[model samples]
Target: MSRFSPFSRSRAPQLLTEVLSRTDAFAPLRAGVEQMSAIRRDLDALLPDYLAASIEPGFIKDGKLALFAAHNALAARLRHLEPRLVADLQARGWALDGVRIRVRPQAVKDPVPPKQARMTPVGAAALQALSEHLEPSPLQAALAKMAARHTKR
Candidate 1:
């Protein structure tokens, strides 16, 4: 029998938390994840839906809780509510002395218009006139061809 069976290529048999908790190397990471999860839950419960949804829990360390805001405006708004948020988390046993907000805006992609093959009527007329004035040569022929190509359909 093949050691790598096709049937065994299914989804993971255990939960991610279960797998991560089992590894000694991931202990600190797991703890950090847990802390962040708690911070998010508490923030969601304490703040308005719009504010809570816009802010992401960055980390909590050395008696400080850090949060990520989508923009400076959001960060400023969060700052206004920071004291209340800190009190709420501290009341809930978070051991937080202060709250810090960081602006971490996500990259936005603007749609670009495709380049168009275009020429003004006046430009084409000028090129055509110049071509006619030139002697019969490769340059004149090339200019005539270019002017014709640029003419409106």
Candidate 2:
């Protein structure tokens, strides 16, 4: 392995917090992130589980609290709750003019398919019987092999 890999640098790795703290624009960026986190916490307390789970506080800027939802359905629901959410944030000491609900869909992983259904004994028997009527061919051979798996030993 090369000695120049990022993790193998001669100097100790600088923490992200340290690096950001040293940057000029980091204060506003960090404050925005923190405010959003607080908004999420407040939403968790104020909203129902179904809404809270699907919704996220995107950012607060220009007197607008932007909310992100996982899909259109949730976005519509959040839009309906806009006034109440704005009130809640105001109650939490956030100075905001409006709430904007946007559909910012999170990446969805494809669900692993369920295990294949096992071949039933009757179905296997049927396949075996059908295979017997056909001349030797790839289809007949495949059916016979499959049917044999379900045969009573």
TM-score of each: 0.63, 0.60
* Global local distance difference test of model 2: 0.85
* TM-score attained by model 1: 0.63
Output the TM-score of candidate 2. 0.60
Pairs that collide in candidate 1 are none
Instruction: Pick out the ten consecutive residues of candidate 2 with the lowest summed lDDT.
Output: 1-10
lDDT per residue for candidate 2 within 1-153, as digits (tens), equals 575878766877886567767977898876766677788889899898999998878777799888888999998888888888889879889899998778888899899999787888889999999999999999999999989977854
Off by over 4 Å in 2: 1-19, 22-25, 115-153
Residue-pair clashes per candidate: 0, 0
